[model samples]
Target chain A: MEITDIGGVLCNGIKEGKYGLGLVRVRGSIAGVFTQNKIRAAPVIVCEENIRDGVVEGVIVNSGNANAYTGEQGMRDAREMCRIAANLLGCEERRVAVASTGVIGRKLDMEWIRKKAPEVYSGLGNSVENAERFGRAIVTTDRFVKKAYSEKARIAAVAKGAGMIAPNMATMLCFAFTSAKFDSGELYDMLRRAADKTFNRLTVDGDTSTNDTVLLISTGKERVERDVFEEELCSVFYSIAKQMARDGEGATKVFEVRVDGARNDEDANLIARAVASSLLVKTAIFGCDPNWGRIIAAAGYSGADVDERITLSLSDGRDEVFLIDSGRPLGNEERARVLMEKAEELVIRLRLEKGNGKGFAIGCDLTYDYVKLNAEYTT
Target chain B: MEITDIGGVLCNGIKEGKYGLGLVRVRGSIAGVFTQNKIRAAPVIVCEENIRDGVVEGVIVNSGNANAYTGEQGMRDAREMCRIAANLLGCEERRVAVASTGVIGRKLDMEWIRKKAPEVYSGLGNSVENAERFGRAIVTTDRFVKKAYSEKARIAAVAKGAGMIAPNMATMLCFAFTSAKFDSGELYDMLRRAADKTFNRLTVDGDTSTNDTVLLISTGKERVERDVFEEELCSVFYSIAKQMARDGEGATKVFEVRVDGARNDEDANLIARAVASSLLVKTAIFGCDPNWGRIIAAAGYSGADVDERITLSLSDGRDEVFLIDSGRPLGNEERARVLMEKAEELVIRLRLEKGNGKGFAIGCDLTYDYVKLNAEYTT
Candidate 1:
């Protein structure tokens, strides 16, 4: 497969101190997923339109201003972004996908974007440094830029987002590029499945964003086995999703919950998500308390209807304790406390004595800084 | 009406230092509202049955341990608590309602309860001191015991609860006493409606507890108009609900959200509840930020489909600002900021220009203190 690292793409800032604009070129067909939130941003709308043709040359993305709810002007700005990217790449405007993330309810800085278009275009290069710039350009409130891929397969992706999480449709900007050949329909199906298993299962603050988008672009420059490509893409997406969860707004550490032997996958998922998204659960983890009751309570309210036939366990990779067995407390208070205090990779496991359906969710502990970071000043 | 406060109520600690047991002696009829959570506690089950005949002498309540998820032993303990109260109050066993609120899943200290029953009964007195002791006896983590009453109608109530705030059936313990005459049928009907408008509309932390119960009692010692009784009872219940909302775990301010002019009350309630229960909205209120976007976002995702024809306003009793008008910002940033910073009672008003239906919810802002109070230690 003729795979190339995304080294040299146009990346710049429409606003100073914030990398708010970027364009990455790839010769391929396009497939994508959009936010399930009915109130979508203008860029999400544009991305949907551009990808309809099943052919895309690249993607143009920005942060700092999610062009959503800015009325008709928001639509115009999104279209103009694609137009600019198309001009720079010498492709049809319909071939350039667009995405925007950050502060919602504002119009994009089209005037600044227009003025800096030439500069960003001129800076395109095919180096790892260029690709790293793409990483740096897409962040919003994210402490670190996240990228994942299989070097052997040349499937690389960069993602940006931390809060407003509870992704119904991967609420963030994620762009993946692959040199492997695949039809648009095939790529779309693969992306949709991978995203559901990964991004859709994650939640941070439980505030779904207005602009959640994920795009997979296959250059068709080289052919690869479908199963291998799917596996690699899913791995990369899952990795990025984990990073987003860990970097959740004011997050202290990653917390993973796995519900096993539920009545079904949906019930397992509901149980896992309930525990992961519970503020009480998050705070308990933050406090380093073996408050397994909160976990069980969350599960009880999840509508899973597992009755009292379940076991709850907690660990920090080293210290592990089964806090509840079949709705009964194990009463290993000291060991549970020790496990909770470790603060690294907290794992909550729930085993329902039903059928063997299992599901899991990755999230982060809630912290005071989360409140400070997201809601300190009136905007 | 022969007005009398809840005096001559036997109250004592089931566990030392935690005044967690009580029996109120009132020759009255009782009606109650319970939690909607499918996972109900033993006390709830007992109360449901005991108060079924509409004849009740008093309530036996315990704090420091919520008798929920305690299995068969829990049910027996709750029944035994009622039996003891019935014996002490000189009434049938079924005439005494039971409630326990504190930590869930742990069985009550039955030995302590049985031993202390005689002391509590012996010390009962018809004095304000006795009534206040009843208030002090039924609290879990509450900083203040909440009470509301109308002296003229001889109606009064006491309640206790703090965390696990979201309630399909208000998860706290509320026991109301009245001298005004009303049958169980009428009392039940009135209590149901009043509780729905009051207790059922309050949320904090969004965790519906397994044990939430509210009971209303009448001595049938004097006759009163149904309208007067209903009005006074609703007002008192609403006042108590407001107190609970304000005192939510670690809340700094009471948050009231009103949705008016919706297609129907159900939709209106959906919108109001969505905003009230939102983590972002609560956190924003906590930070005193006039971040109206979070409010609109919450409403947008509330399945309300409110298009661009809605108005969102925020006020703190006096200061007010129309933040959004028909999906457009009013640009009254300073006023909104001023209104938010007051930190006493924050009211978010949403007006949909669709119909005249209206609904409201009372909640509390999410605070770091709430996390500390609810999740500091493992059970």
Candidate 2:
């Protein structure tokens, strides 16, 4: 297994504003997932086509503009990006996936991109700095860098997204590389399963973006067992997903939610994601108010099979206590206050007593800073 | 036709710690609409039973507790409220519809409530002060008193809500009265039609509350044609609903939205409400972004049939210009700025060119004040 130094070029482009871009090359089969929003960005469309052949050699990410909603010209620009990357990497354009993230609706500056492609290619080398650069280049409004490495040091991932997107689908960007033996189909099935329980369950805001995407590459340089690789992938995705929730635009703490004892996984997820998406619950956590009624109310409206015979509890990653038991308030203000006052993480646990199914989702508390950060710009 | 002074009593209850409550008695056939949430509040449950007889002589509101999710005791407390109001108003308990709004799940302070019922009854009179009291008493976190009197001087209405509740349903409490000659059937039909285009279109924080109700009463003293009364009711509800949006918790302005040229009324409403309920669009309006892309994106995801052939415009209730023409940015910053800068109200005009059916919805911008007001407490 080898690392590449090309990530620095991608990082440099974003920092310099010459072009918001990044690139990483791997000799492997690749699989990907894209946003479900009907309105698709040009690069997302480009990536969709390039991944069809299953053999992917590299990934190129551009920032500064989303290259979305630009009509036909936008499509041409995205294709040109792949063409440029292919030329530099000495691979077919179809084997290279390209992604763009930034403000939506603006046209990409291809002239600047054309000039930087060769530089990013020359910068490629086997190193951790290259991976870090790749992570830095993909960021949009993210407050912190999110990347993870597997225990055996064969798998690595970088992700960037701070704004709230959606449940059931992603509205951010992610890329993972592994020196594990797998075909595109095998990798895609595993990636989708892992994502459904990871990034897909994380919501920042309710708005779904047009540029969400995730790519997984199997470099085949090392032979890790499938089960172990899956475990590592899930772990890495969890860490990055948690980071995204923690660094949610203007967020102060990560809000972790678990919905348990439901009739099925779907019901559990429905309630858990609904609780995560609720601005009232978010703000309650933000203000240090352990108001479990809001949580129950949100669950009631989640289209899940919820009744009065449910219990709700809150914790600060340590001490936990039920605020509502069997649909009645169990007042414990002192313990709740101490738990809610945590500055890093807040946890909500729900038990429905309806079934054994359970699900989890993460969100950030809504704060004045969140509104300020998101509302100040026109994007 | 006459105006009563009982409003002051209602308003006073809200102002003092005595109650966030109101009661208005009229000799009429009454019709009502309530929230569709499965987790019905105790007061909502009681109102549902009373509104059935089609002979609502009075409306008794008890504030300070929502009387929701409080189990059997909450049910008893709500019925008891009607029992007390029936005794004081010289009517059967079934003749009075009851409503409650405040923090959810706590038991009603019946001792305090029993002490205030008689004072409220004694304070009732035939003056505008009484009507003011009724309006004031219904408020929870409302920053303004909302009331409307029809131009014909035969109809008056009062409403209170500052958050989003339901789409096909309501999330606020409103009471309206008329001396027009109509049966409960006619008035209910009129009220439902008017509300569908007015209150149903208004959105705040997109969180559906468990307790939401609207009641209309007819005194049968004056004769107005059904069409005319419907028109009048629509106008009154529009005015009050606009005020609710304008004063939404900490909202700064009423964000008005109009969806036109749709395939059907449902499609138009779906698109319009989607635009109104979007946090991204709300935050943009609050930030004075004039970012039309967010509006288009929201419409696309509204579960309505939409394509590239649509036009979007912004206005400040007067001057207006296109932000997107047939899915392309119109690039008119100057006009958009003036329209978005209006302090009182801003408008979004959509032309889908799909058909003639149109729809309207009202919402408030995402602002720091909303977070501050809602986050400070656990309600």
Candidate 3:
């Protein structure tokens, strides 16, 4: 499941050393950052140091057990993972970043990694098959593998995330390697901006995980301009984010709530996110009620600088629109029919008189399937 | 359903000329205001002007039809109801306040008013039958009548609001007449404060009605200090708010989420409300999962200054404590069992290591019954 539309690549293979997919080892010049949660995994410490110098060669990732909250033993296992990966790849242990995503509060099996790391390294390749395996290896409750690749700057990227997602961070993990050239500082800034527009705009169950991370490594095989790389990387990041939104738990329709004419960009985001996450609005969308009252009511109580006199337009991804002025629906029967007939996407526009500000957010309708999926998830 | 606790002198009668419920029409002085929504109602306009000059004697209330959104014809009907009451009470029409609560967008029939006013005035008396009838007459979708009386102040307050509630100005129509002797200015202040803390704290499906109003009438019978009257009035109002929350559609348990030590009061409220209103947390409560993770996650993403290292505690009331600290559950199995057994009322404590600020919010569990209630509401 590679997003070939984006020019990125992913690879996964088994290791014969102590640091296999299920073992412990941090190897490769791959820089990464962990979620800012206080209860971070030991792998996050290793990943943070590797990125401190603003450069990395590769990443070592494993699943089946997340070495988080395991006390001092967790740290020792993480260090041992780095030693094995570094020795095999002929790189210093400090340059290699490590990441693990699985059940928490468990220590890694270092002996298995020491035996499997060599075989996994030997199998690594820059082919589509490896990319698929990498996507599958990082998954936990995900229904499908998520990977995207783009060729705009001759760059490659891939990611895996599904549930327990919310704003600012997601519960899953992602790793992207690109051939384009860029410094570590530039990559960090670009990743933050892209994430703000992408991962930060999503909410599956509004839960942020303790072991969430994204590691971006530059192979430096191609020397692309800094500006072009940033732009293309942002585009690719947004594309993957859209895919994540589409794959939201039991989601059928992906709704993009775009709020304009707010007091500021932050205000717009606040108002838009409130509407997107409102249960009334989501359920109404599921029932196809076209209940404009719920929509206006959500905006009014969003704690945003909203004036009742703001003009509103509700469109269904088309020319059909319902215009609301001064908190009352305007127009005749033809307009109502048009709004009802249009399908696929619902676009609500709010023009506030306060200031020239805007907000964009992504969401999905709340179907009965969504309730069923989450209610019986563990069972 | 008469709330006999907040005892007030009882009087119920039919008014042909005023349409209905026109038993008590005291004509001397009055003060009143209307909702700011542009969709003006006929009664709102008539009452807005008559209540000026800090004097109102006669009040004409009609049920079965709300004279709202009927344009000029509705305004005329509201004035005519007041005119009949004023003429019968031998007072200036300007001293008469009019109120109409029922279905929206329907014009009132003046012929019914021409015959009902004198009959109602003739039957005015302080009796339990009238008080019960008054409570019953004001209802719309409520399963039972609600009326309250306070024996300490010889003041009684009765309200009618069951559906389409969620308050900014107030929730539905509440006409509370007190016998306490207080100045008009003092009464206005007390009413405003009580309305803010009580009606404003509740949310029923988060829907704000177009015809919500709360009017406090002082009969000037019992002389008391202004401060004492304010306290009594607030207590009475809080009782009404609690009933509304308990009677909320499909709510199984009432929960109070308190977030303390936040950076500011606004941030605390944001986090507390976020956790209280989270569908995931509510559903978990319904399932009795004792899942504190969802509650903390909701606070984290509530756009508040959340320190994940902060302390958290869950209780099945005030005494039976369950999870304390972050993710570590109680080692005592007996304590966990005791907590799980008592699930009538739950409280979640989210302590952030910021400034000394706190917020309190109340909500109910989300169940399949709740979904059924809302999903099939209009249908």
For the second chain, the TM-scores of the candidates in order are 0.94, 0.92, 0.80
The prediction achieving the highest lDDT against the true structure is 1
Across A158-259, the per-residue lDDT of candidate 2 in tens digits comes to 788876532312247888877677899989998988877788788422335678888988767667888887888888888888888877767777877898
| TM-scores, one per candidate | 0.93, 0.93, 0.76
lDDT for residue A292 in candidate 2, whole number 0-100 = 73
Candidate 1 per-residue C-alpha lDDT over B321-371 given as tens digits, one digit per residue, 9 for 90 to 100: 898888787778777777777659988999987788799988788787876
lDDT of 2 by residue, B149-204 (tens): 68573777777776542221224788887778788888789888887778767732
Q: Write the per-residue lDDT of candidate 3 for residues A229-321, one digit (tens) a residue.
A: 777777776776667666666555566778888899887887777667666566556555555545555665566776555666666765646
> How much is the lDDT of residue B160 in candidate 3?
63
Provide the RMSD of all predictions against the true structure, rounded to 1 decimal: 3.0, 3.2, 6.2
Docking class of 2: acceptable
Per residue, candidate 1 scores C-alpha lDDT tens digits across A111-143 of 888887667677766666666666676787788
Scoring each candidate complex against the real one, what DockQ results? 0.44, 0.46, 0.17
Deviation of model 3 at A78, angstroms: 7.1
| Number of residue pairs clashing in candidate 3, backbone atoms closer than 3 angstroms, sequence gap of 3 or more or interchain | 61
Stretches of candidate 1 exceeding 4 Å from the true structure? A1-15, A164-171, A204-207, A317-319, A354-356, B1-16, B151-153, B164-171, B204-207, B354-357
